[model samples]
Target: APQIGPFSMSDGPANSGDMVSTSCSIVKGDFPVEILWLHNGEPIDQGNQDITITKINKHMSAISIESVAARHAGEYTCIAKNRAGNVSHSTSLTVN
Candidate 1:
């Protein structure tokens, strides 16, 4: 199974137009791991210009928001899956 580690975000509440980012990493897992970001249980829209998803490395993935808006405030989750199994971690974003 895949074990996730060090899932985190910026230190404090974010303001409108502020940039926010988070990272998800797999501490123990098999190869060919798939990582994804979701907002309130729904997949994030990659088509949005302000959103950027990056594969930091083989075991790490990151998502960044160039300009956070009111609608951006919600539960953000990072899910990792491989042939063995899957795991997820979630964090909340507070926009001011």
Candidate 2:
């Protein structure tokens, strides 16, 4: 089985127009694990201009949002999975 490490935010509550980032790491997961980001329980599109995913390393990844709006405030989830198993971590983003 694999585990998704804790979710972390680059900063606390963000104001409208502020840039924010969130990240999670994979543990005990096989290589080529798929990493997905969800906002308010919905998958974030890779082509979205406001949001972007960055691969920090083999086991670490991050999602960044530019000029966050009120709608960006929601529960964010990081899901890491492979053939063996899957794991997830969630955190909340508050925008003012």
Q: What does candidate 1 score on TM?
A: 0.91
lDDT of each: 0.86, 0.83
Q: Candidate 1: worst 10 consecutive residues by lDDT? A: 3-12
Please, what's the RMSD in Å of model 2?
A: 1.5
lDDT by residue (1-96, candidate 2, tens digit) is 568877666467888898888778887767788888888899988788888989898788889987899888889998888898777889998898
Give each model's clash number: 0, 0
User: TM-score of every model?
Assistant: 0.91, 0.88
Query: Ten residues in a row with the worst lDDT in model 2?
Result: 1-10
Q: What would the C-alpha RMSD of candidate 1 be, to one decimal place?
A: 1.2
Top lDDT: which candidate number?
A: 1
- Pairs with steric clashes in candidate 1: none
Residue 18, model 2: Cα distance from true site in angstroms: 1.4
Candidate 1: tens digits of C-alpha lDDT, residues 5-81: 86556677899999999889889989899998898888986686767898899899989998999888888898899
